[model samples]
Target: MSTLAGEFKSAYSAGSGDALAAVFTPIGTQNKPYRLQSFYDFTNAASLQKDLSFALFHGKSLKVPRAEQTAWVDIFAAYWEAVGELLKYEQDWPGASLVAIFTAWKKVANALIRGYSSSAGIPAWTLPCLYTVGKYLRTFAINADIKAAPQGASSFGFQDDVAADIEKNAHLEEAARIINRMFTLCLSDRAPMEESRKWGIYQTTNLIFKTYFRINSVGLTKNLLRAINAQSADLPPLEAFPKSHIVTFEYYVGVIHFLDENYAEVREDAFFRVIGLTQLMQAEKHLATAWSMCHRGASKNRELILTYLIPCHLVTTHTLPSDQLLAPFPRLEKLFRPLSNCIRKGDLVGFDKAMSAGEEEFVKRRIYLPLERGRDIALRNLFRKVFIVGGFEEAKEGQTSLRRTRVPVVEFAAALRIGTHATGRTRIDMDEVECLLSNLIYKGLMKGYIARERGIVVLSKNNSAFPGTGV
Candidate 1:
């Protein structure tokens, strides 16, 4: 007849105070005696351990239907309340309560996810819930570690908990997989690039990138990259995002490639793509800091790299909150950590480590992973012209007025600044641009366009006229 009897009739329930007190203390009683509601709260919280354990181990047999979503929400909410109680008393139980809290948090996460797709079919709110749980887990882990450090205590390994959960559970993987699959399906199938859905997709993808970057498992990184590529065709034009999601993806891909030691790929794909995201970078301070590093490269080759790369770094580090950003990227902090050492010793190795670390972290999180392949295609277009003279010029309509009938090849090094589309017949005498252009022409980056009847010359398209690749 009791409410607890009706609501928590499931075998998973752990019963009331005397029963639970044996396992953990009774902390949530608001009034005199233990009522049905109290029992409901107590039982649900304890049940979280069982729920998560079951989901992690036995998810294969589970089926989450639309009608059960609400039930799951109630189940999760009860657990959430219980966990709050546990945290308040974590000082008392230490390891035991910490483990219990972790287990219960997992259950709440499971319940929320199960409820994500309701009778309405995939509640629009599921993405938010997913991100919230991810953040909560992350925060809880940090807090727990911080609490344990002073006491000389360590257990319930929070990172291991998350890693294991993700590694073991089909549902968590499916949650990530399904969102990625949706993006891929929509993009490849030419499904409408609905703005409404992209926000959620972007956040989820962003989380996946952060997690994999933390683990530094090349296998995970490779898989995430493949997923991004899978949906590349369905992505909206890069022009669709000037500041937010688009720039974020580009920044991640670039840094990931940098870490992977694919320098040429970083240069062609990330460094050159900065023009599109420049507006976004200029407004963000952290971007400016990284941009300073971009300019710190050695030699003309490195200098050329810094042009676009600086922007990518800034976009990655500054655009998102520091907490939400890819701070956990493996070996990333280690790379930057040596900056002080470099400054202290004035050593090249330390300098290189710091520079590469900062730059690579930015590139992976912001440039490479989430970019559509169209971006790759764009990068390739510019890559073809990297060795060509005047190829970096921003040539518009192929001519610089009647006086300058053809886009002239300045020295290659000079062309790096002005781009492939110079407008006037200024009779520039830069030897670097001339040599670069001539070499490119020889190498096929610049095809000679001659009007035989008019005895005039024209510059062929340097792929997309330098707009797409930033050259």
Candidate 2:
């Protein structure tokens, strides 16, 4: 095998398409080798170096003293631009067939990432290389040909070629097979109790799970959980790392459990774990008081709004008053402040607006836009349910009725602690104005019969909707 340095020199000098294609001839008959060479010629070198430096040296794979993964990432990034350009020029090729190839590579890359995480097992700061590798790997996979089983398997217990090969062959189903086998092996020892090296191994396992989670590959996630349970020993509790990861994980798990209608388990297991992780992160004290206040409010731990949520809002603020300042965490303060405010006030309207604003800001900063976009959509949907109840204007099909009205209910009423309103000039949700006409129930509003079925508010005299019920 050629030394990495020698390969780099040869690949670098192989400037043109023919020369680049030559570099990969030794690897295989597949077009991926040529594509890799073409990629290096097209991509920027300095930026790749910078990103790789941080990922490889600072995070996971600290146990493995090699920069090969990082190099692979850099190579793949360049390869993408090159091959994509070539494909763009090749108008004669069928787009559908090429797309299938991309799909196959995507699976292969995911499997590689999971396999590496299982093998390396280290902190995030030390494994930046993995990120770069995984990024292009996933990109390649997405673009690979996703059809038949690849011809180059059984050597590595999987296919031998990179994502480019799969795309060329359109062997997605076979690529998926190889990927699944790798995934199965990677997750074979998922449970924390199965292995003695708890910290790194557990964290890496979670990382692998997160890879699946990121893709919404719930089947893989379920299989991983099963493996963990099967391998786990009936022993004491497990400790987590970075604290933030645990907090984030528990939060997602709780959401899953909640969706599954396992409310009791969510409260008992997920809630406590999240709370503990938050505390461990020193979010309760190390940060500003507002953050602590908001955190408490978000958890609904007490009726009073804790200062925790403030930090989330403060993070978003470009400027803040000296007295109400957030922490000094760059960019984060600006990002968190508005979210915290929305959570603290239980203002679904505010949350929706803030989330949109956050996404725009992230895009402007050239940050990862997709994650924020997904998050924005998620929060928007979440608050939509909490803020407004949709209903049609049920008047005669062709006739507009003046008496037509819609009913509204506060989704967060159970959590919002305040004075009740029987009837008066109350500021109801903007979207739920129709619902307000039928029922104006508040902590200290009008005293009357809530005719929920008919969507009518029977109030006393001087009340907004009903004058005879009670003011």
Candidate 3:
């Protein structure tokens, strides 16, 4: 039985990504018969079509595995060898040729993907080619109607759109049809290749996304996302895939959620530093690398977001990554710095301004949703600072930090307006100040209860103001 990975042991051994110029390049020099070119190049359409058809027609089907994973590799190798001929298209092939290839490719590709599992290994070229195979159907079908001027018109660029919607849509339909089929094959709940399929599916899904992104179509990925999330409990952990795949998968998946403002799903819970990837973004990159990793995924190229968000004030105490890989998260740090500062000082107005200023930056990074949760950070910090302020100036062992904490709402309101000189209002809105304080205590930023009847704020003396934050 033939195995693509075994054939290119050197490349697979080299880990992910071809050290060669292009990703799709042949691993060891025994060149593949077909090479990829533009969609509009039809220098020898008739001959190319005829030759490819004959090649696929007479192509020998080698006896490979019928068992779980081996069956998939056998099927993929056979299917790719057939489509490999079609991949040599210059630009556009006859609409008939497109139809013929899609049918043949889909029939075989679908069958094998059904048996896909983590039990099998994927060939480097197999995945890249599989993606292109599907993508070309969409691209060439669109260009079929784009003909050159009879006498002579502008013989370049996207001249005109003459393809009928039916024809154009048929091509798109075929592309989606293939994607859906693969989705069912690889992502089934009891999928035979469930374990290995997890990562293989990422490569498959990445191509699907590339397909959708190409036409600038929106929302096509939502269903795909739903399907994965539906079986998320059974889905393998990040450690199951190659570190390289992890980065690419997380990059696409994380960005997908970020763009849609589906931040809560990414965090799913909470920990610290880079709230989005609580466990994923932390400092475990060193152990994960190209092909040599034990089970670790490399850092965000440097600094792994620490397990604990080392407070900006005590950054010195945290174990930092080397400078090369320890780059601070661009947008996360942008939001964290301001939110942390205002919370430390209990500056309500400053908090507002910081959020307003960083709003554009967050949106630009497509992380607005996750960063929006920074609101909780500010609330916690502001109240954290306020708790400190209400404490005695001089500390003594065995004494409660909140000994002088019985304060009136009116006084607390005055405290909020302390740094405001322009308005210089001696009185602040009682409702707003209490509302803010109420939220702080409710969220466990402080340990205390509100005395609505007396309008006095009683701070907790027995424990730290912040929950789980006591000494």
lDDT (Cα, tens digit) per residue for candidate 1, span 143-225:
44445445543333312322321223323343344334433322333223442334355555555554454334434656766
Q: Which stretches of candidate 2 lie over 4 Å from their true place?
A: 1-136, 141-180, 189-208, 211-223, 234-471
Give residue 99's lDDT in candidate 3 (0 to 100). 48
Compare the candidates by lDDT and give the number of the best one: 3
* Local accuracy by lDDT, each model: 0.40, 0.37, 0.46
> lDDT per residue, candidate 3, 1-471, as tens digits?
122323333333454333311322322234633232221132243354343233222233322223533444344344444344455343354543544555555555554444443344343234443444444444543333223113332222221111132323445555666776665545663634433334456666755664554333436777887887887776776577656555544444433433333333354333423343332232122223321332344444222222122221122122222333223454345545665566455565676677689776444333344444445555555455555566563557886443455667776565567744335566667888888887667545567778989998887665555665551
**Tens digits of lDDT, candidate 2, 225-250:** 56657755632244434454344334
Regions of model 3 farther than 4 Å from truth = 1-43, 53-128, 132-178, 188-199, 206-240, 246-336, 364-366, 369-376, 393-402, 419-426, 468-471
**In terms of TM-score, which candidate is stronger, 1 or 2?**
1
Give TM-scores for every candidate, taking all chains together and pairing residue i with residue i. 0.38, 0.32, 0.52
Residue 284 Cα positional deviation in candidate 3, in Å, after optimal superposition: 16
TM-score of model number 2: 0.32
**Candidate 1 — which residues are off by over 4 angstroms?**
1-75, 78-82, 85-91, 94-97, 117-122, 141-198, 234-244, 262-471
State which candidate has the highest TM-score.
3
